[model samples]
Target: MRHPHTRTTRRRVLGALTAGLLCAAGLATAAPAAPAQARAGVPGLADGLALTPPMGFNNWNSTHCRADFNESMVKGIADLFVAKGLKDAGYQYVNLDDCWALPQRDADGKLVPDPARFPHGIKAVADYVHAKGLRLGIYTSAGTRTCNSAGFPGALGHEYGDAQQFADWGVDYLKYDNCNNQGVDAKQRYTTMRDALRAASRTTGRPIVYSICEWGENKPWEWASGVGHLWRTTGDISDNWGSMLSILKQNLPLAPYAGPGHWNDPDMLEVGNGGMTDTEYRSHFSLWSVMAAPLLIGTDLRKASPATFDILDNKEVIAVDQDPLGRQGTVVSSAGGRWVIAKEMTDGSRAVALFNESGTAQRIATTAAAVGLSDAPAYTLRDLWQHRGYNTAGTIAATVPAHGTVLLRVSADPHWAANPPAAELGLDASPLLEAATPATLTSTVTDLGRTSARRVSVSLTGPDGWTVQPASATTAATLATGRTLRTAWKVTAPPGTPTGAYALTLRADYRSPAGERVTSALPLTASVVVRPPAGTSYLSGLTWLSATSGWGPVERDTSNGESAAGDGHPITIGGTVYARGLGAHAPSDVSFYTGKACTKVTADVGVDDEKGPKGTVAFEIRADGTKVASTGVLTNAMPAQPLTADITGAQVVDLVVTDAGDGNDSDHADWANASVSCGGAAPAVRGD
Candidate 1:
């Protein structure tokens, strides 16, 4: 066959012979973003490792070790996954979280399956998973002890050997946790297991997907890409709306790190959990799809109701997940609890999601033209959950439910020939009613299979008394103007922009060199809030910064009841201090609720002046502990400087600051500012 590049090669040779001409033409330039290539599927797994997002049953949040982990229960769920076509939909991995391991290892330094729950042994169970065409996943900690207090006989000094055993047992996915990899960097600890998995894979001749369960310690995004397929980006998500929303909010900053080869894990799904309503669960699924997160179901597949299955099986909704684009959408604009986001799909289509996250329903209106399309292309508009299709003019006026979402897949309208346009321009899902930036008015013109436009001109009538800046422009007739050339300008925070919602007339004129003129006018609107209205605080009282999960620093303080005992109650830490909720329990047997960031921590020890050790308090931070902050001291006088320390990726450190005194009135101590810096932390793994 003739080589197609021969002529191009000859041209290149001639260009080499005529370098000046080639330079003058400027035809050569670096390729844009490396010619979009097909992404290789996940490593050491089938090509469809993540076809539609991993979905299956989990032990925690559902079974929760509540006596439902028997072999029959596992097989029953497996049967349901198959019967529900979940496996056919690409939900293959059946994962187990903490609390499944036995309390002790055998005499040979090997993990022993709990005989009471698994008489056939874990290997036999894994065989059952493979037999059912589903892969098996298991969880374990890098520490000597598991999160649920089960001691690992081989975990203390046998991480690699243990990984080999998991591979030997035919485990396909391993959620390696950071329970007690003390004195080691979190990245290092995870890396240790990664290497172990590789070695084990070599020995067992079976590929395993290494899942780093560091609980968002360090900043997983920073190093997660090269280390694991997926990393948890937030603490465990609960079945409540607050938990789901909080995890979503926490993942916003980690978007840049998500891609085809890697994902951001917002923990597991709580679709069938009891804390939230069906609407909230739908919202959860909607947001997760938008965020491109892994869809690991933490509910019992066998017991989920019809509503749960409906939410999970909506193909329209799942399309967002399976979209080859693999790009997570971002909130382009937000106002008054309303949000507009844009997501790019693999098929070159964009999904615009308009949502009302407030307490009541809101009217979401937009023009296809405003969303940057004119003579609007054909669109297949459907409510993802409702599965109803509505074909209409360029404008869309949908009454969006409160805390609900409207996802629209907008593309070139193809049925224009069949349906004559009554208007010159149309709007798609563009939230023109809530424009947020000066760039909102920007629009991209389509040539419509014809020559491109030379110049495009647009104009807007001043709103009421408002004035237009740099108001007018002249352009070549390339744009068919009458609204066909989606043209609009975003409202700016103009010096005198109004303080309330307002609408104005927008006009566009496309003139050809031959003197042909096309003009059109439509209503353009926007909201201008000089300052955001104030309301009751969403989060109340003292908010302590949480320590990073896995390993990091712990800010020390000696104020607010620092004693030998550790109480989980909130205490005032001087200076600005924070603490993350480390998985480790407080000495007082209570769980700490730090608000995701802090260096200093305090305990709630009320005034006990009569006690001999009135001012006595003690706090500790260890390498094995998840939160890491510098040691802080509290005194009656003199300024205190922050303690200097280095927290390499994933290393655990103990932080302790205390105030103690013998029986005496002079025994007084004040503590504050207990927090940890995430600079040296592991990258969070996000599954979008």
Candidate 2:
């Protein structure tokens, strides 16, 4: 279940004409269908649902019953499933989360779709989805009420009736929640719903995919395979790297319980939520797919960016998740933030992932024999992200970026020439740049395949207004195996460009031995920033080049309380209140361009008082990636502790807050009266 603090505000308008309207729409007056033959129970569902992990969209993470989650929005999602090629990509179900219902059930104990939200009721929505060749999924809790604060009725005691109603209404999937469960036995409650669904499926001849969302509270993996098609193995996932990584760690150990028709779900996909970078999002998608977890998208598809769609529409990666083998990838090695995971495929191949969970790039390596693949003289390595193929003598390795993953498919095949030759591309340049300043960037393309690449060419392109000029030869007549082509370009950000990260593309085009054209591209980020004026100032007054948090936006001159901006009170720690500072949640980083002018940074740091005596956090100040100051662990009971760091000659200064060993619950940290000392005269700083 999602944390109560993050629940969206519920609409309390009760539809007085719900029953009458439903009857008028013929949704309530329809006669029940005859029951079909009964199916066997236990071990797993005999109906053979969810043969592959369910792929679709669920509205809870993005909308959460907000006003936009209405009939039109749900219908629009179904339309996108067709127009955006998602339906063809194997996405089947269009699920609605909580807040789609009224505050209470109708007169006859029937669930009422909030008339304002679903004026035509759920059946109409299901019909529209089914018309688009897609399935429909609905949510309800096992307890008396749903997870939302609105306290909408659940299907606990009315399991059979509710299941029957869903079947009659054309619901093809059910996300059974665990909240408000009233201390009932986990297995018993889930099993009851499973039985009810089976009975309903027989009557309606419609098999509804059952998703057990118990949040891993009762070790559902140990018993849920026989009860539901899929079971959530973790709590609600927040749209941050820390939260995502934590959940991934929790789900990776339960691989043995998942198989075809039954899966261990690690919650929904947060790839397009905007809290994390595109690199991190790609890592999220890659990790989930390799683990064979359900790929229920949790973002508003209508407003998603092209990059989001690219990550979601990667057919190669999706194939790994939907692989008929149904083997969840297992961790082959993990140490010092480097990890190697391998999943065995049905065709005697292996899908391997080189993941970097640390703060820097690390080269992760493994062999085919190590990942359960038979030893061969040479194995074809398919880079899932690059969409290219390479041949190696059983050695598979790549330098993965921080919070990134390199996914590859390894297979020993005699017909390897049918695929494109493998080429690796890289970009070397400072990610941070000043407006209008020309920077030199180098791109290197390496031929890692067994055959040589012919007529290889490389080019760099930036945003529309930016300039990119070749500084060295960008073409090569021939590149032999194990050889690299290095090219340089002078790139300049246009004057007056906004101070934020802009995408740059480094592309390589070459011809394989069989005369097939191959293209490999790498995305790079360049942040244009303004340097601080030559003076002392409070850090909060300056615009941050980048800001990320675990729960919400980083607050200025306040405490991190909730997900909304400016929702925090004053920055209070212990018995003191500081009016000027930063209120950041644990697992946060805020960076500013200092331009080597700032000499030192000072602050009084501690866990914020708003969190009471609950949180434990540590603070660190980094100048140009070198730690200059640190605070060990400070709890809410501790007073403000003064600290200072010399940041002389540093181009960037970073304020980082991390959860101290324990989980990041209520870990709101404050940098009290944080100030930067720069050369020259003092300047006025902004404050609330």
Candidate 3:
């Protein structure tokens, strides 16, 4: 693990020559780009070596420095590539990563393959690969020793000789590393080998794809196009998610520098390595394809699973990488750990991927306009994995599973035979949280895509401390293109939690349009708001109007409680009618009128909490719901403010409150001891 098989050298010649190199690229764009052959006038080397980012198998991921890199191992993989139909699918080269050469060069100063490892010699291995219609690839370091230094003399001082030997051996690719170079100038050192490769090609007429394996320290994308066919953009890539994500970040920014002949390599593909889940590997392949990175397989091909083959041999997905345009995709939008990467394919259409890196599934969306084609004419869309095709006006959306991707190919053409059958789930689900009501999130799903989804079921989840229970997802026997389903979930916030939006996730699992045999999940979050309700306690305020009719909230009147309206301070009230949480807001209405009256109706009201109202709580006793006995406005908060209304002939009353002149500012009008007596009877109204 010293340097992930290769170390990056500094940027001396590379940085200095970056500007000129970029300029030359601009001129090349005028000519038709030959993906198989485009050389920017670099001397010696021929045009078109690593056209389309060299596809083949490598031995690093499955077999490390266990001396398992013998000729037999490589030969097995090369044969499997053909047997598995990978050759027809465009996999051409079979590469050996490191420790493949003998301890020292022969006395004639030529590199040698290990006698026991390659009994017939490296040339014979090359012949074996070539006979199978596959190219042969070999590895070495620029330093005095390889990463493992398993005895082979490094190519530090023998660049020309090593390149010539590889050419003579019929090697189709050379992965030149930078192991123990003692901090040499990366551009200068790589430039030396570039010239050597050119010289070797002239002398032998064999074109070897020169891979600049100096890692990414020199920013190879800025200058490597002039020297090699491909250059490593990141150190090493692991099979896990975190490692892969970091490596992808390094490669993404260098997309513009990648073209037909030169590519930005983010290490090799770790597919079929058994290190990650199937969903993760799918995401890996999708990302690499969009980036247009090298598809060098780093796995034990002999034992690859059926799923692995399906992922690797995905032709439609592969076409995105091998597009004649050779442009790498970039993130169009990223939110909630979901990313939408878009690349324009050679066909004037686009290839987009909805990638979810979050631990849970996520609903990711992107319009045709977002990917630069909203205004284009009618187009055909294909889901690469599901192999389903359909027509679209232009927008594409999908609910991606965790660590998964929804790969799409958008073509500008309106006609096509059945390209692929793909099914997508569009679930509109979210939460509406209020302090006054129990929280519930509802998710309604509709499948309008081409394919029919099977056995759709859903589940709900939330963050820590909060409780959430989602109704079981309705099992749909066949969710055809026009079918719809819905599910609901209730959320409960733990006591003492502040008021704000919390993510409540709804996950749906179902079979794709393919079948009910395999399952996929879609996740989306509903922001559940948790805060105490505002305004008067239902018990304190008599029967009132609806929420829209100025019926404010009723919350606990505690210290720091939101008893005031529009986010104000708490209020204090001394009354048995209201509970721990009480809210009294002005601009409110209540009625207590019935025609049977008492002597006088009296009540003592104070500011609900300290954040008292600026208005007065006036009582109007009426004979028929009309105002008779008036208390006017009691705006005093000192001592005792008693409001008495003479019942005389009034059998009913109307209690209306309003903020003085300041709209509803400080409208925390608490009407304590509020009553409407009839014949020495209690106020005929009570609130909960």
For every model shown, what is its TM-score relative to the native structure? Answer: 0.55, 0.79, 0.62
What does the lDDT come to for candidate 3?
0.64
Deviation from truth (RMSD, Å), model 3: 20.8
How well is each residue in 135-191 modelled by candidate 1, as lDDT tens digits?
Answer: 888888755555553334325356666888889989888787655444357775676
CA-lDDT, candidates in order: 0.51, 0.82, 0.64
Candidate 2 per-residue C-alpha lDDT over 1-688 given as tens digits, one digit per residue, 9 for 90 to 100: 5852242111112222232433353332322332332234336665778999999999988887689999999999999989999888889999998888888778887888899999999999999999999999999987666878677887777788899999999999999997666566888788888878877887899899999998787899988887899999876788888678767888898899999999999999998988888999999999999999999999999999999999998999999999998999999998755799999898989999999875444557777889988766577888898787777656677656667899999999876656656777776534567889987877888776667899999988999989999999999988887788998888889888888878887789999877888877666667788877666677788788766666777898888765778888899988899889999887777888888877988899998887656788899999877789999999988899998999999988888887775546678889989988777656455333
Please report, as a residue range, the 10-residue window in candidate 2 with the lowest summed lDDT.
8-17
List ranges where model 3 is wrong by over 4 Å: 1-46, 149-151, 374-378, 416-441, 447-485, 489-688
Candidate 1 TM-score over all chains jointly: 0.55
Q: Residue 76: error of model 2 in Å?
A: 4.9
lDDT (C-alpha) at residue 56 in model 2: 97
Name the 10 consecutive residues with the lowest summed lDDT in model 1. Answer: 582-591
Better of 1 and 3 by lDDT: 3
Off by over 4 Å in 1: 1-53, 150-156, 364-378, 392-397, 413-688
